[model samples]
Target: MHRQSVAARARQALQSKPRASQHRKTRGRVALSNNHRAFRHELHYITRGGGRPVILVHGIAASHSEWGHLIPDLAACGYHVYAPDLPGHGNSPKPGDAQYYQVESLLVQLETWIESLNLQEPPLLIGHSLGGYLGLAYARDHSGEVRGLVLINPLYSPRQLSPVLNLMRKRPQLGEKALRATPKWVIQALVHLDPSAATQFSPQIRQQIAADYKRASPNIVYLTQSLPDMTASLPLVKAPTLVIWGEKDLSLNPASFPELVKLLPNAAGCPIAGCGHQPHLCKHQEVNRLVLEFMNSAAVAR
Candidate 1:
């Protein structure tokens, strides 16, 4: 009953072109409480479009701008979008304490954010990389609050993580020291050296990622310390899911998609041919079309 009502409301919203939200990007802050140490933190978000809500979560070292191309597209299709910079990334606060980086703590803070939005109906959650991990966790823990999930090259295993991140997860102090010691150019070289990123990312996309990443919190690596636990929570996610991946995503194991599909109770997936980590930007039209079709089919199913 509730699902159908929400759909009807969405349909009603589509009757008019949502002019106010069209192409206009609004950045703002909201006070959200983190479960870790009961700390209150301010979350920064970018919102665009209006209508049935769609939440976009970017990976570590990235922000809401990661969806620059997709945001306007979704808005034009009559879906309101909210893209947030998870703590320690983008414009959101970076806490000095390590506990705030725990996977559970991040998930709780995200849940609080959704609740505060008073979305009236569940919002579709879409995330990339660590963002995908957060979206998956949100769907798993608060199944009743999400309309569906779209995980793009999501983080699943510690093995899929970068060497520096993996090292950080193992030896916190050494990892911190290494992260601090690594030169900016060396870090870029390590990432770009990966064939996935080296061959695929357009110069424009690469530049954008580089600029956004430079501002990312140094302690951001700690966010993945609880990877195994989050990976274990996968089977518990009840929302219908669409797993999108880039076939050449060395950033996160490309082969992990099939395994992810198997673990999800109600899920489907697609791999973008010749694409790399940033499939949405790498192949915006195809990715956008897939998302539209998936949402349409999901609505019909509901």
Candidate 2:
């Protein structure tokens, strides 16, 4: 009953927004595949360009569209990029079951997505925030299958939460209800609290984000609830890795960057000055250069 009400409200809110046709067209095409047997749903992804494969994963409450700036840049540089909306976000089908939002479930879906594509070699994996956490987990379990990894402002553990979020973490049912009932403006305000996040997007991308949040709010809540300690997997990842962090990231503990670098035997760190959590979007040019450099170096090492 409550879920239905929330869905109804979201649909109403979505109806009030400008149609997708009003915005600039997306560069990538939406492709669907049913390669993952564990989940009985087709995976939706945006794939563009053709060359060395690069799989881009987005963070919580975001879709593949989050890579709007970096996708074309990567494709222009001779890399075939695949950015999936994950399971419960973007154009992908969202299941009502909370189990679908678990970190382990997302990792399995990623592995299956790769297998379905049947790449000649392990493609490079680049993830931001929760996506970064998922990428690390995938690299650790299937070390040889990944060419390299790039983590941009990755979240390894629970972020320092506010009183409301802390309460939400403790009482997930209440959190879900609250998130479902919250207005889009409220959510957007919270997201844009970090000035960098607000300045990173153009007006078009901002609209897309607002829509994504409306649909993926429940998934976001669940993901926050399932935040796990990623420290255990850090030592096990054998893939060449690059950890890029925003110098002024207010979301995750900045101190974790050095500690994360210390854990990975074959990893390097680069901090973007005067940036926040969404460095890939705001500081994309610098981020792209670092990504290209790291990928090129990894290829030479091989």
Candidate 3:
């Protein structure tokens, strides 16, 4: 009997070993294939709660795991949350095609995935960094598709990007080569240096980010090349928006906050003092509160 019990324990550990964390929810993975390149892989995501839908889009080089702190509460609060890893990030299958990294292709594929869900209502979109940029584009294209928007340190102007990204944008070939050459230990060491985690690093989260960063494809550097001028598109994004920023963000300049807010006609700006680029990570409770308040507003009610 003792031997049998030991065998059972070993099997259980094997089953749980693949999961990144114990986020309370049912998770799923949808496969996406780039027809041109013939590369395909699962698009991993978590869906939970029961009332209105809310979709959380994480930034580049990160995964749905970054949304860990925010998910349980949002799920408990009656929101049917959907958090998916972008095509190449997180647990999603990293396609080999460089074109798959293009903003337009990604946006189209993202829309296709959302449409397949056949949501009960237009979702409330909350996006961070590169995800925020994609969210803005989504709102602009389908103004009536989303009830509200929450942007966290979004990538708007290329000028506001972190030094690393700028180098990638300007020197594409070198950037890809360098990214490929970066050792895991170097990335793990650098993860702690991000101002976003200056307050304290959640060991599991920090490790996960570092691992994902190291595993991310060199092709993803291509995303840095094409940033659309949001000046024309911002006005078209009629959905109610809440722009959240971290005063201490090292990745994107905080100065772009006002500029972004000024452009979104129905948007409001929320700047957290001493916060970093990922507000959800730095000030999750505050981020949740603000999102709840916004979702309950009259504009979003309709």
Which candidate should be chosen as best, given lDDT against the real structure?
3
- Give per-residue CA lDDT, model 2, range 140-202, as digits (tens): 766577899999988776644345655666677886787688888776667676667766756
Record all residue pairs in model 3 with backbone atoms less than 3 Å apart, i.e. clashing.
none
Question: Local error of candidate 1 at 193, Å?
Answer: 2.5
Q: Flag regions of model 2 displaced more than 4 Å.
A: 1-38, 159-167, 198-201, 298-302
**Whole-structure CA lDDT of model 1:** 0.74
Which of the two, 1 or 3, has more lDDT?
Answer: 3
lDDT of 3 at 116: 56
lDDT of 3 at 83: 92
Score each candidate by Cα lDDT: 0.74, 0.73, 0.76
TM-score of every model? 0.82, 0.82, 0.85
Stronger candidate by lDDT (2 vs 3): 3
Per-residue lDDT tens digits for candidate 1, residues 96-192, read 7665666656665676676667675778999998888878876775656688899888986777766656667877777556666776666666657
Worst 10 residues of 2 by lDDT: 17-26
Give the C-alpha miss distance for residue 248 in model 3, angstroms. Answer: 1.3
Candidate 1 wrongly placed segments (more than 4 Å): 1-27, 34-38, 162-164, 181-191, 196-199, 299-302
Candidate numbers sorted by TM-score from highest down: 3, 1, 2
